[model samples]
Target: MTVTERRATTRAAPGPRPAQPPRAVAVGVPRLLYVLALAGLALLTLPVLALLVRADWPGVPAAITSPEALSALGLSLRTALAATALCLLLGVPLAVVLARTPTRAADVVRALVTLPLVLPPTVGGIALLYLLGRRGLVGEQLDLLFGIRIPFTTTAVVIAQAFVALPFLVIALEGALRSAGDRYEVVAATLGAGRWTVLRRITLPLAAPGLVSGTVLCFARALGEFGATALFAGNSAGVTRTMPLAIYTAFNGAGVTQDSAVALSLLLVVVAVVILVLARAWKPGGRG
Candidate 1:
């Protein structure tokens, strides 16, 4: 090496060593927390396990396939689907309003919309009755104008289910909308897109995942609806008798046996499980 080069190399200090990244911490959960978690899990799971164990596995197929059971299942599916549709129709607009608007009145409206989630289902049924029963204010006007009956009917069942399930759809969609923010929507507006176009093309597409999840939750809640349905629609055979109602009937009614109730309960559980699994597996249209 040249003397000048050697002198320069010796004069310069070595570059600072590259900084090492910090190591991740290893967390140790307390034993008490583990015990409590296990206890809570057991509390939630043991009853379902007991029901499964109590069910007459050999008789389940025959019991659930009987004419009465089949009718109830069919009615439940129809009403639940109808209710889910209703929730989607009404909930999307409501969620949009709630997510976009920032006002006290909007907060009150949101609370009112979700009130049924905390209210007892039976109270909801009574409220429905007061609002739509034959003697009700709206019902009386409807009957006077069109001779329409509201209570103790298939329509009533759908309304009851929708009433109870609407909150789930609204909450989910609102959260999704809030998380998605208004960036794309603002850009669309700047580009001269109309409100409806922005909603249809950008907002709805972005929130599709939440919409699917909310729809599934609403459908499941509707499928298991009982107290509101019973009080508002009545548990008539092949009519308002949904699976939950049928299970209740079979357990208490003189015509059906407890074994049938157990079978129907198992069927409902299986259906719920399948829906949850499908919801988890579902991928939104635009998600990566």
Candidate 2:
């Protein structure tokens, strides 16, 4: 080797080495924290366990199959399904917009979109009523032009459910989109793919895990909607009443017994548990 190359290699070898990060220190969890966490868990779960303890297990079938119960269950399922469909239709596009927009504008839009999540159900119901009631802003115009009434109808049930559930899908899908980054989209665009093609092929596929979990959450939330549905749609048996409304009615001694309410409540609890299990399965690194 030449003398110059030898000298350069020797100089480089004696240069300062790069710094290494310190190792993580293992910290022990406090016993108090553990105790508090256990308490919190119990606080959330005890009510459900108590409900099971009191439920009329043998009478569940009879209560669930009663004509009114059947009508409420059917209505709940149908409306929840419709609400979920509506969520997927509008929420996907809104999520994409939130994902791609500038930070400031996105924050504003996201806040507005997620408002209903924190808003009380009764407040939401009241707001919906004012906006869509026969004498309301847009409702009055509709009444004059098309003679269409919105509140206290089966359609109001769907609207209330969708209003509350939309944020679940939007928040989930947006998180997925942000995590996925824009690398693939940039490549697709450079390859001459249009925005629609890129979204259809790359964005949605990458966000599939979030989409599945979001859809499940949306459906579950819609299924359990009560205050909004009660206020906006009323408690019409064949048209508007859902399982939660039925349970509320029975609990208040309108016509059905407390046993029937407990049974229907158990059914809802079961549906919630199944949905949570399904959601866990669709998480990014989950079993499914």
Candidate closest to the true structure, highest lDDT:
1
The 10-residue segment of model 1 with minimum total lDDT is: 279-288
Question: lDDT for model 1, on a 0 to 1 scale?
Answer: 0.93
Q: Pick the candidate with the highest TM-score.
A: 1
Over the stretch 36-95, how does candidate 1's per-residue lDDT look in tens digits? 999999999998999999888888889989999899999999999999999999999999
| Residue 254, candidate 1: alpha-carbon lDDT | 46
Tell me the deviation in Å of residue 100 in model 1: 0.5
Number of clashes in every candidate structure?
0, 0
Off by over 4 Å in 2: 1-26, 254-256, 282-287
Task: Provide the lDDT at 271 for model 1.
Answer: 96
lDDT of 1 at 198: 97
Colliding residue pairs in candidate 1: none
Task: Give residue 14's error in model 2 in angstroms.
Answer: 26
